[model samples]
Target: MIDEHATPDLLELAARYGVSREFVDWRGRLTTVSASTLIAVLRALDVDASTPDAIRSALGDTELAPWRRPLPASIVQRAGDTPWIFVHLPHGAQFRAWAVLEDGSTRDIPQIDNWIDPREVDGVLTGRATIVVPADMPRGWHELFVAITDDGATERIARCPLITVPERLNTAAANDETKRFGIMAQSYQLRSNTSWGIGDTRDLGALASWGARQGASFVLVNPLHAPAPVEPIEPSPYLPTSRRFRDPLVLHLDVIPAVQLLEGPDAERFATLSRRATALNATPTIDRDVVWRAKREGLELLFDYDLKDPVRKRAFGMFCEREGQELVDFATYCALAEEFGADWRAWPQALHDVSGQAVSEFRDTRADRVEFWRWVQWLTEEQLLEVQRSACEAGMSLGIMHDLAVGVHPYGADSWAMPEALARGVSVGAPPDMFNQLGQNWSQPPWRPDRLAELGYKPYRDMLRAALRCGGALRIDHILGLFRLWWIPEGQTPDAGCYVRYDVEAMLGILALEAERAGALVVGEDMGVVPPETRDTLAHFNIDGTSVLWFERGMSDEPLAPEHYRAHALASVTTHDLPPTAGYLKLDHVRLRHELGLLEVALEDEIQRERATIEEVLDTLRARGALASAASSVEEHTLALHRYLASSSARLMGVSLADLAGDTRSVNQPGTHREYPNWCVPLGNGSGERVTLEQVIASEWAVTLLEASRR
Candidate 1:
């Protein structure tokens, strides 16, 4: 029986748009999306479903929208497979179809006869003709060109983007027989004596070198994506202003070549600023505003230094030319954010449109400021390249593995520059699960699936290219999002949202293609409320999935044995969302969640259940001889947990830098924002003392655990 709130027509329209009417929740209970929620979500996708007449009209348009287009806006296929496209034209009309390769070559596409009835539109007959693409076409971005004529006179011409991607990702480790381990850390949380407050690429280079000496294979860090250019920047890396560019705040000034140009008061001011920022390392929390202000001032001084060398100028020109208009657009957004507030919506109406005359005039008038931002990105990228080089030189099989966040802030640069690519009036989040009973609203806008296809997934491709350019591997956060996202309507609670599906094949294909181009590895974060077939698909594409020690369970809800762990996974004992191994041993997650009012049940009961799960895992570890029966110390338990992970068939094992340093606090909490000071927490030892990267390298616990994992 159907709910009274949703009419049959409304349900049909929602289904046509890939919106779910009912789905199983995390708790294995069936939940129906309300009609009001459906209408709001449908409105977000630019469909009208508020009234019966609107639903009927949308249903009709949905049926004919494909027929109206001569060819679909885009076509994506595997490199080795032939893809067919349907072209619509006046009944019995003649047309020529061909593909223009990315290298400027052309190929004739032959037509195939597939039986389909003709439809009349506006008293004119229309037929759909199938055309076959050559399987031997080069794997790159190309275009399908169609010409329709009447009596040899060209009537219409249309073009569609053709993306030929790899059948499987390039993962060297997938074929290697050896098991490798790496250090996972939040890039900003890592501090060193040389860093000005927050961690820099230089710190990452040092950490990677040290880890390599300890027989590590890689260093996985948090997203280095840019935040708002203004003060009071959003602290969470997952909520970046733009995912397509790196944040300049992480640039280490001392190592930058431009810093050598400063003299007199400018040099003295830079030194004083650097000292003040370095003093921030002694504190327990990261003041990002103070850090950015100091870094921005230092960057401006460097930007002001004149470049008299022709070679340097040419290098800068080459970078700008290579980046092209996308870099220009991002830089322009940064400059405008400085003048107007960070939120583009609050800016003058004319400036809101990134391509409009007003914004163009603004860019022309404030060209210097825009250039300054662009130069900063170039500098940041230069340092990033050095860090990766150092990692590889240190003998890392996979160097710095960058993380890709799931979405972007609704009011940030990406949304401002490409408004059509993002959906309006809705945010991305998760429904209720075992840990987060109340659900979560991330406040980040979901990508518009339809628009992304129409635009040929350029935005997505650009982001992946930038992320993989200098890294050996990339970890996609919340990779489940590629298949479907939970869409929460504006002003609605997260539980009221419904799932919206995407073109998963296209998304995964493009990701694999980019990774293949860069010769990098891909690890998908496939945790939390995942569909059963999602992991299979990831493995089919040679993309590794994430597996945590505490979450692995068997049919009886007991901890899984080491041999049962997935081989194509990045196995870890702990994650950033949870406390380090030492803290988890003390039941910190349960206690903290209880204190934050994030628990639906009684705190004691939750703690009891958690303790029971921990005991079961410990028992398994002891039975496997990974832990001694008499081992009761936190350090012993932590080491034993990792030793257990080392025994797994998992191709890659990730050791958290926090755990290695004996850190007891979590770098992030899942549900709460301001209540817990989430991403601001600095790296510390068990005694809660702030430690620099140099000190962490010399830490006894870190050394011992790393050695144990290697053995």
Candidate 2:
């Protein structure tokens, strides 16, 4: 039932706009969205529904809005399924339209639908024309152009974006339909001999090379999305200032081209800084701020150095040209953040608008600083491209699978850049579940669904394009967000939140288009309390789902049989949210939960429940003949669990680097910020010894694990 305050017209308008009035909650009970929440969310969408009369007016505006535009901003058609676009024209108007292909070719499109009676829209007599796309139209982001004639004269020209999407994505591996396996590790924690205290793109390149040699098909990594470039640097890769850029901290100073140009004293100082970083590498914790500070000082010298190689300079200039205004906007934010603070909302009013007169004046004064920031982005892009290029050269099918975080930080560049497109009063979050009764508020702003559609989903498309440009595969952090998101109003607890629906068809279609274009695989993290139809819908889009060994159980006490696992899923023994396989066997998660006071039940009860769960896993592994050793050491348990994962029918298998090293610690534990050192832990083996990538690559243990993975 709709809320009492919402009239029939208001409810209809909300439904038409994809706003949910009620939904089944986590408890499987009918939950109604509060009236205040709906009104606030509507207002955030720029829908004027403040009163019943305003609701009627908004509905009228919505109906006539399409007529105001010559054509919708975007049109999506399936690869082989023909679809028509409705065109609005003044009465007695004639138009000839055609689609411009990516290769600069054009295909003429014809109007298929019969004429319709002219209707008055905003005092204009608008008639409808249906343009039908050919069934065999190639899939791509094409442009549509129309020459219009009205009042016996042809003068007006209209253009719009035409997106042809594949009904389902088929990755390169899917062509052969053979099962593939890869290694999953936190990119930041993967230390190497050449790294500057923390892992860098060079380390990623080394790991990819070694993993390919070990028969791995891909190297999945944590989100490398850039954090704020300042002291008090962010540690978690998941919380990035801008998902579109890479942090300069991940650059290997020795490998940068400009570093070669450093003269006598500068070269010596750079080496000194590099050696200083070496001292921090041996520690068990990764201090991102310290690492960034050291790298920043060295990079600043390179930033000031003039270029001698015209070839490299031209390439950098082309990159800047290709990136266009987005790069400029991001660089401007970075330059301003350096002067102001990380939170753009806290900046002075004169510097608040990124494109305003005041900001332009600031840009003129700080042109050098802005250029320096853009140069940093170009440098990262160079390194990232090389890392992926190395992986593919090393013969991996899907090289350097990048992780995409669910959302950007609340006060970061993205939020400040697109204030109107992002919801302000509500933050992305989750409802109260059995594991977390208090619920969760991620503090990341949710995208305004209405605004996203109005913009023809350019923001989402641009993000996917950036993510896939340098990688063979992309792992969407929280894939469920495409369907719906739990939005918690600001200044309120998550319990008061409600689920807001999204335009999933449009979203998924665009994802398919981008994936097809880049020849990249897409894996969605569709774990943890998913809706019943989610897996099915994802399968329809050919987006692979994740299957963790720990949670792959049916209604009974036994684990789900390996053969019963979904064929389209990526089977893995553990994920970043859990303790590494070895630590999971040791029940380290339970202890950590208890330490964080995250356990709601009595500690003993929790332990007992975990005991039963672990027993079930061991029993199933033994029954399936997956266990090789009689002794129940951490390494043996991890290998056995991985063997079970390999036995699955799932197309992709992911083995953790930590599991191979026999590490018993978690890289990240949910529900804790600074409480448990979430994303800053170093990679350690089962023997409780931290190991660098060089050690791990050559270790016999990794070879043994790779054998199991291949089996």
Candidate 3:
């Protein structure tokens, strides 16, 4: 319940900033946000809403904000829609508006009627002038220039960035009606004999090739976003250090040209590291720290050799030039992390800001280390592109569909470099949901909605561009965040959070623009706590949704029929958050949650509920002729589940490699960090024995299940 003492002024201020005062909870109960929580969230957005006077002042600011500026921060619109742009100026001042196109051409914007008078702002009389943009304007990045004339004298000109995007993104293939199947794998868990303890681009390429051979059209992998450059790296890809860059750790060293030039001693040293790292494949859990230590030594050797080659140096320079300052800041952060520590907050205050002189000097002084990180990124880009090329050549229609994590680590490169781009005292999270009643705090900073519009969404656009660079498709994890994010105030429980809304029109417009430019398909992980109209909006943008078989229920809470499934979605039997199909059938997730103390109810009660759910799904499959009434084996059930997915009208089907190998371990367990080894489970068999990539691909069980998916 909200604080009884909260005044209407405070509630109005919160509403003005797009904050939700009350929301329906997972239990269908209306929950009002506490006044304190609202104040804290407002403060995080740089609004001083602690007192009545403060609330009044903030409310005034929000209304006068647009009038104070001559032109808006940015204008984003769909290609065919012609929108009116308001130009603010001193009363009686004349202004002319035009657009500087992306190709250096210009278009005149006509003035329109504006009867509403602007109020006095800061004691200066201001008036709004309406400008009608041409409907035939090209779809690209352009600049809107507004020049104001006062008393027949030319005043200063204001410029605003403008973008026109396609009306909706389309399916990756020309034929949108056709259904396609793909294989989903945790990238690092798919180790091979040639891997250096973790799966690399080589392994991913191999998987893509194998999937193509199985009549698959794509391979979906975990987010390959960069982690901490030094040791003690974060294991979960969902909590990446930077979303704007690729993780160099996933690069295949054998593909680097510099590796071929190693001398006798250098070769032996690299071989020793490779041999030691490859031996890690026999281990049950992935040790990223151990893998990094060995791989780093070899990477340094390659970096040194590449520096000496003129052609390689030129290629690196071109890459740097193309990446610009964002790449430099990431490399500088990595170098600084290696010198001091991964946490930038603990460093000296002068070194905290990437733009500060102290950090610039550190980059100049530790030039070699900074260059090494840049070189690593270049190698990563090369290998990822090569893998995509290989996948396409091997007959995969969509090739690799890359996963994009929702946000960056709170103390990672993005936060350290561009602190203003994200909120300071809030974390992105979910309100209490059915799975975890305590809710989930991802510990990642949410982008400041106000700042995103002010900056013309450059940070968001840059990160999306990077994720879509080398993949045929990109999956936006927690895509609902683009419209509204649950903002949990610092030092408070996740349930104390309120929803903060974003400009969905602008966000989706930019997304459509980027995806169209990349010629990639977009899939939104719209699974949990989604707003009622979110799917409709996503579908309008032609962005696909996610559908996990177990969660798709009908009005009676029974399994949804295959024909009832969404046609514009990526359907799968299970996701990384849940156990494999075999493990799910055996109630492994319920048992694991009970063991981790994450279950709200008794273990037996939870187990009984889970069993009922599985039985209901089996009944649906049996009715559809995809399963036998007497079938009891895990393999049989897994195939039946695949058959159920195949019978659906979903445009894309994803089969997890874990299910193919009969791996029982959950890739991740929500709400448990150290208690359960999240994101560390290697691909293995039912007996808990480690299975190599080749073995998983060649397994008869894998072939049989894949054949079922193609039905």
Candidate 4:
């Protein structure tokens, strides 16, 4: 029945959709596709009049035909009564309805005829449907599943998952009335007098004791997300192999009881590595690969001893049980990837697909290696918990505030584990904006919104639960992606990308539910071309927005005064991407950008003008008596700016450690990777020396900033 010769060439189709041929071939024929390509092909076939509204409607209706519907606004029931449910459908489509009880039994509800018709309301198609259940339905908990039935077929066209009822809200509000603030740190930066190259948990515990003395609430850390199992590893936290597990490189080897029992040459090797590690802490810049390699070699020596430890073995069992099959699959993938290479596609045919028999055989054959990977995760988790406990014992109101990256690496374990959820042929990126004229291609696979909806957002919910487990609060990077994202086809320029929309209602609902459950506050990084309604939506859910100093400006070419800062936002002088306060004041960032070839002629001139304007604003602050007369030098001016920011009406503030020490280099350079040495700079010592972790916290600048902030 198939005509192989008539089929479109994969490369030609990829060109038509502006995607990579590899992504197309991976999906196996033209039936399945990445969301970006699917949408592009639909437009190519439609030949409709290209109005913005028409394009959006077509994209929403056609590309998402398999997954689109509306559900009831809320489900309500009295205690010890049968739950009553209601739903408002988008159009009058025959639906197969079922109530999934707490016991996992699905009871079908007979459908009624002609529910509701879609009408043009405010220039948009709007439809409604409502269904109420009997008062004597069931007593416990339940959920509703609604599926649109296809003509003459038992199969459903679209399905939506909805909460049937709630028993109670279990999370309690914080009893303390004190405001909280947190700092993000690198584990290697926390050094002790006995530390081997970088800071360890012992140093972190010491810092926690110091933070308590200063009345600080918490200390956030960079993604402790596990790095690759291989050597010459990816150092960027944003490009982790597994976001679910903590990196073993940060583990304090001395704390492990089994390490003391080792003997012979293996023990001597451990001693030599320990001494080298201690020396590494005194060095500038974290050598992640070297640190991890040392830790791994030391860990391998203790592997046999760890297997005999009953308590450790039990802990490992508990961890495996808690994580379920996903953890095993991730670790298995990591071990195999290291042996093969980072890319899964390049692996042997049998091992290529994680769900196949070849992977199962491999797992059975390499059970010890699998268990070793699991043990590493368990130890990492244990240490991270210890760090949190230390923070709480130090009188911190919030233990740690973790950051959730926008997306995961394309070739990483997450993508391999859940290929169905990810868009294979597309890369997540930003559209061309004023700051980044060329736009950005992050090379990270985005979640297929439709597939996620079909699966009731189980994967997303799990990710959020894992991220929120150890943190008091979580910062969602690129929070706007929850509503919509710009999906650039693999081989296309960012300008060729189109916006793919998400169900904002469902996304907000899930977020609110998670935050309520965790008893945690949510902060959204709501920067860059945010939709007009985004702020209002965030406000409705009590989510805090981010406000940075450089972007704050009034309508009449006036600088946004300190008083104008929003009450429900985190007001900061600068973010990780921007220049530190000292760098901005001295215009070092401009020169850095030029060196990285990120600055063009027009933008370079514009930056200079902005710098002049900033200086003028600082002068105005001095003239108005807002700033002290001592704020004459650039260093003093930078400090005054921070003081003004701290005194703002915003509920939260973030003071970068880089700014405290006048560190000129940025943690990340937006445009270039190899051309720029990003995420490698250490906090400066102000004496033209790169400061050690101990020196950073003990600096006069750090002390002054802390004192001023408390006031």
Candidate 5:
């Protein structure tokens, strides 16, 4: 099955290395090789492998020139396909491989030569095949050619254009222009007057408006991504039911036209609910269930009144047309989840398959349910767009950057819609890093990278397009996943997870292309265990990285200066994971971390040290004549941090609204779920009353920070 001319003679190489052909086969299949094995291969090839450093030195000094090849046509494999062909070549060299069809047209294919298997080689010269064609190519005379060109020197090595037409199209070309950012209002305390129960779309719109006014080009909100169908829902935005749809709980039910149509006692009940919603908005803590319930009830009444308004129906039709089968499958998953208690596995066998007859019948019989779900998406999109409009009107440059979660819930709508895309038996998470030694199992299903690639990365491309549609930018949570992800097998601890690689070239390329089309910028969440190369790669693409204040300490044991910050980074004093500025100053952050078992050292000592450091920095500012107008109070100090961030060399700066209002609690506490009230707090005053957007701007501290930064 192997082409002799296109591959290295494995038996010959095996003999040269004094290793059997079987051993070579094993090495090719092994994902990770030991240092000894690596050394043996190097030594067998007459290369230095005495020590690890020696091996590196020898390879670095080789000075071998790169091999070049001609462009190849795109080839894709799908389910039930056989004989996958891979062209191998050296890394850091430009080679093109294109297929010549019957019409004499050429199509480009992806090239990767950094690593190759000796036994299964197809496209190689000397020890490698320059190109390989699948054995399943049609029984016709075809010519496949591989040209090696380096520094303008061209050499034709092999030629084959006889491959059969694959079932799918390959669309893995990389684009380098998309920028992303994140928003965190849900963590902020809610003000009562404008929000319903917690901070709803109205507040989100106002925040977007504020962001735009601050000269931000775009504002990225957390996954407005929908959650599971069942009650007592997971509050984490990362664990979403459907990445394609928005959460209904965030709907501004009061703004809907049907609310005005309520009559008599119905109107009174609606008024009472509105009043309660307004009251709840004043509360410090966000009651998600309560808000969801209120909104659901209100929506039910609205749905009953105007089940199919012309505009709403048209909007639904548009969504259906835009999303196509993906939306249909997602809505079906939601309906099925609702009936089967959120677990598709627990549902009847007929409903298990999205394309099954049961689903088709359900769609026909329960058309209203499907239409209602679609309507919810339409309204959600409308509200988000309105937020964007408000931001643009407010004179913000970028405005409304949205956050894209890393993965979808295991049993959520996305998994149901694209079961083949997700690894049903494994989950996505982080390996043990400096921050969390125990590691983290996010409990969200990850896409099967191989499957996604085979399908030409349609799912990923669609997602990026959707996210960039409404926002000026997008913040990819765990942005490293675009390159590699730690995959934990089912029933295993997170520590048992192993790093699975991804097509970084395709990922970044698609992102850049989409962002260029959408006129947006990209920001990667490169916090925690980010490799140095990741930063370098992101910088190469003009994608901004994140810089948080607490983590900006230098190796020299000195604080990082604002001027030292990279211009291609988004600088902020704190993030949703850290304590708000006010809470940090009050030492509440120290106590909270201690209580949550996150603190390893003495809490008092840590707090005192941190406080001293802050004071020392303030003193430095005073000495430099930069603190003369700085605020003296804790709230004022918080404002000063914003001013510092704003004045930093970084191109963009983010001010958490929680800090603006002096809210103490963090929006999320990483490890603990039930133990900590993560994602439950609203933006509000210390007394638990939800603060309105006006209140936030009116606050003396907010005004002080905003004005000080201007000076």
Candidate 6:
């Protein structure tokens, strides 16, 4: 419950900042937040609401904040819609507002409202006024300028960032609202003849080509976001060091032009490293650290090569210019991570801030190391671009739908470089729910809602811009975070946390703007417990939702009929978190969770519940004629599952690569990390023997299974 002793001033202040006093829990019961947690969250947002005097001061500050500013940090609206802009000035001051077009032209804006009641605070007289914007503004970012004068003798200027979005998000494709099937794969686990210990962009291209041959229109892969630049590289792609850059570890060295320069001694070293790394391909699990060590040595040698291609040099320079300080700061953090440690929090105080003098000096002194990291990013971009090109050339219409991770690693590059962009004490997580009764703290910081507004959402916008550059489609993991995130206060249980709100209109508008510019389709992973109207809201913005076949069943425990599925969604039979259908039909996930001690009930009791669920699925499949007979094998059930998906009206039907390749291991088991080889599991057979990409592309079962997905 909220603090019984809280002053009205504090309560009001919290409300104005979008702090909720009570919420309905997963059980659909009303729940109130504790006082300490609210105070901690408020403090994280830089509000001092600890005492009665502090509450009074905060209330006054909130009232005067908008009054002091001539304009808000930014204003967003739909194209052809006019919204009133507010301006504050000295009492009785007169002001005229105009829109400054991006091309340096100006248009007059008329005043809309009468004088806001005058007020005297701290012996200073202040007043507010409103400007009426024209309804025919263009669909881009422009500037709002207000010129003010107390007595027409002195002049003052105020400017704010203004944006107008499309009335609705344009569909990802022109005439593809109907069903289209694609393959979903964990890229790193894609075993192939040419894999260099780990999967590379080349393997992704090959997979797309194979999928296209099988009559697929798109291929969605896991997040390829970069991990730590140095050794001890993070394994999971979802927790990346930087969302704004690609991981070089996934690069195919054979495609780099610089590899041709290794003709003498460099060639020998490269071959040795290549041989050592490729040896691991025969193994069942991927060791990212070993792979990085070998790949880094090769990249180091390539970085020293003198490139004489002026055109390529110019392109690299343009990339640097476009990325600007963000790229530099990431590279600098990578360099310093080697010097002090990967965690910037424990680093010397002078080096904590990326903008500080110490970091500048370090970059100047360690220029070679910095450039080496930057060079890696350039190479990564080239290869990713090539991957998209290869996929399109192979006839995949919506080729390479890249996944965008929801958060960054807590102690990684983004956290180190831009601390102000994220909150410090609170972590983004979920409350205790039916899916996870213990609750889940992702261990990544949430973006401070106040800070994001103050910075005009540049950081969020920049990340989207980078992620959309090389892919034909972009997938946002956990898209609900754009509207509201569950912020767990430091050292507290997840249930003690509260929701922190964001400007959904602004976030979705910027996302739509960027996706449109990239000519890419947007897909939101709108699975699990989300806010009411989440699907409708995503649909309003033309963002496709995610639908899993297993969870689409009705209250009667029967799979939904084809007509019951969503029309604007990417429907799949299984996701990375669950096992392939073959494995699921055998109760593999239930067994694994039980073994991991993650089950809330007794193993036998849970098994009974799952068995009932499985029986229902089988009955549903039988009724739809998807299953051939009552004695169908596991592989047959897998096909039946996808056969059901193919009949759905969903826009994009997705078939897992694991099912196609006959791999049984889950790519990720959400409850446990080290207990299972989460992201390291290779695509293999039932015997746990690794299956090469060559085998998969030519597998008869794969060919047979794909037919079930073709409508």
RMSD vs true structure, all candidates: 1.6, 2.5, 1.5, 8.4, 11.5, 2.0
Write the residue-wise lDDT of candidate 6 on 55-89 in tens digits: 77888888878877778888887778888877878
Candidate 1, 458-486: lDDT as tens digits: 99999999999878999999998999999
Consecutive 10-residue window with the lowest summed lDDT within model 2:
169-178
Better candidate by TM-score, 4 or 6: 6
Q: How far is candidate 1 from the true structure (C-alpha RMSD, Å)?
A: 1.6
- What is the C-alpha local distance difference test score of each model? 0.90, 0.83, 0.89, 0.66, 0.63, 0.83
Q: How does residue 174 of candidate 3 score in lDDT?
A: 24
Pairs in steric clash, model 3: none
For model 1, the stretches where C-alpha displacement exceeds 4 angstroms are 1-4, 171-174
lDDT of 5 at 115: 51
Clashing pairs for model 1 are none
Question: What clash count does candidate 6 reach?
Answer: 0
Q: What is the lDDT of candidate 4?
A: 0.66
Error of 3 at 524 (Å): 0.3
Span of 10 residues, lowest total lDDT, candidate 3: 169-178
Can you write out model 5's per-residue Cα lDDT over 473-509, one digit (the tens) per residue? Answer: 7778889898767666577776555555666656776
Off by over 4 Å in 5: 1-184, 187-191, 210-218, 260-269, 282-284, 304-308, 432-437, 608-623, 628-632, 686-690
Give a tens-digit lDDT track for model 2, residues 1-711.
334576778778777777778877667888787776777667767787778778888998888888898888677777888777888888888899999987789999988966678899878888989888898888787888888899888569988878788888876744446788999988888888778889898888998898898888899988888888877888878888888787787888887778878999998999899998978889879999889889988888887663457887788789889988888888888888888989988899877777789888887899988888888889888889999999989999888898999888888888877776788878887776765667777878888887786676788888899899889899998898899888887788887877778878888999988888788889999976578898999989988899988778776736898999988888898899888877877788888888888787887888889888887888888877887537477777767777778878999999988877778888887777778888888988776678988888888988898888883
